[model samples]
Target: MSARDAPRPRVHVVHAHSEADSFVTAMKNVIVAEFRDTGHQVTVSDLHAKNFNPVASPRDFLERSDASRLVYPLEQRHGYATGTLAADIHEEIEPVLAADLLVFTFPVYWFGAPAILKGWFDRVLLSGVCYGGKRVYGRGGLAGKRAFSAFSLGAKEGMFGADGIHGELVTGMMRHLFQGTMGYVGLDVVQPFGGYNVPYIAQDKREGLLDELRAVVRNLDDRPVLAVPDLDDFSEKLLPLHENPAVS
Candidate 1:
């Protein structure tokens, strides 16, 4: 396809921070705007701003609380409460299914994803569709999709290395969470771009971080990577779907 005729990359950016003024929130806005400027279809799932319901409801129980009747499917009750899941899912899933890239923008809290974003994972990346079913072989339901994460932190960079308080770079900590979990579900992770020391960094340093963030989006791979089976059933491997090294 020609540049204009080529399918524009679709990105589902899930923002997890509660405050708009927070550095992570600001980064989400900037990244969305930049992606849009490049003609990508950007769908922002503002988890907190939407007051997204974090806890799964009765419908998620092994035996759904309500057997009244259903519109989508009986299995959907196992997916999420049709009555209580955030309405945004209706609007979000289409783009998510169509998306070429899925970007999660959030602040790392307690060495993990923010609660709201984690809830999104719990609710949206459901059992039947996103993963786990007779149709799937531990291969993610999102088998062909790609995932990326951009994180912002307020601590000094030195606090994350082998000798630091966390004793791991931000990415190192995210590997299992991102790779083992999300990657296991079929999304190949690109090297994540993280901004550290946000609270103490000077204006120039923050600007530098923004530059790095921009590069991350600009450099996003046009095609997703393929996650295939490894020798063991418990393990899996990923290979870049596209052969062109220049694209990376």
Candidate 2:
């Protein structure tokens, strides 16, 4: 079907920031607005506002597979199979299942997502449901869905390059967030929107960043997705048969 004749895409934004006035929040708002203007259905999971629990413990499962031994992944696999996962987890999963596009907006904490957002990945992206066994990489449960990350860093752009103190923002995040989390679950990961030195930048520059973010959101469907290795390229033990090129 032609793009115009297709159904409106369902977009879910998981906004992880304590302060509503933060630059990250503004970036999220820009995304939501742009998507809405383009006729996409949008849903925002405001983690902090909803007081989401970031810690993953026994509370996530209603009935554990083993009463004494608590192996989280096994329990997740069992809970998802049995439909006995916690109410909160089920609540979060609904929006994720309905989404055609998922966007995460947060401020980088120690070169990674904030703890709350990390917890969302831990608790909501369940094993049997989102992935398990052969359901990973390109063959993952959520394959064909698209995802993007919009985040800000405390360090300047220069500090994230090859020879800088932080060393390559995209490369570092590829290991932790993009390839590890989103791509692991089969989402077609899009290039991230990184706002560097957000806290230290001037007012005009920050506003310019917001404008750039709006443009990114508006053109999301046209953007090139990051290339991930197909499952067929791996062996039975899941080792790559050929050398994988660096993401940089």
lDDT of 1 at 63: 45
Highest lDDT model number: 2
- Report the C-alpha lDDT of model 2 over 191-214, residue by residue, as the tens digit: 989998899989999999999998
What lDDT score is found at residue 106 in candidate 1?
A: 88
Clash pairs detected, candidate 2: 160-168
lDDT of every model, 2 decimals: 0.69, 0.88
In model 2, the runs with Cα more than 4 Å from the true position are 1-6, 242-248
Model 1: per-residue lDDT, tens digit, 53-84?
76655444344435565433334445354444
Candidate 1 Cα misplacement greater than 4 A, ranges: 59-88, 133-138, 162-165, 222-248
Name the weakest run of 10 consecutive residues (lDDT summed) in model 1: 231-240
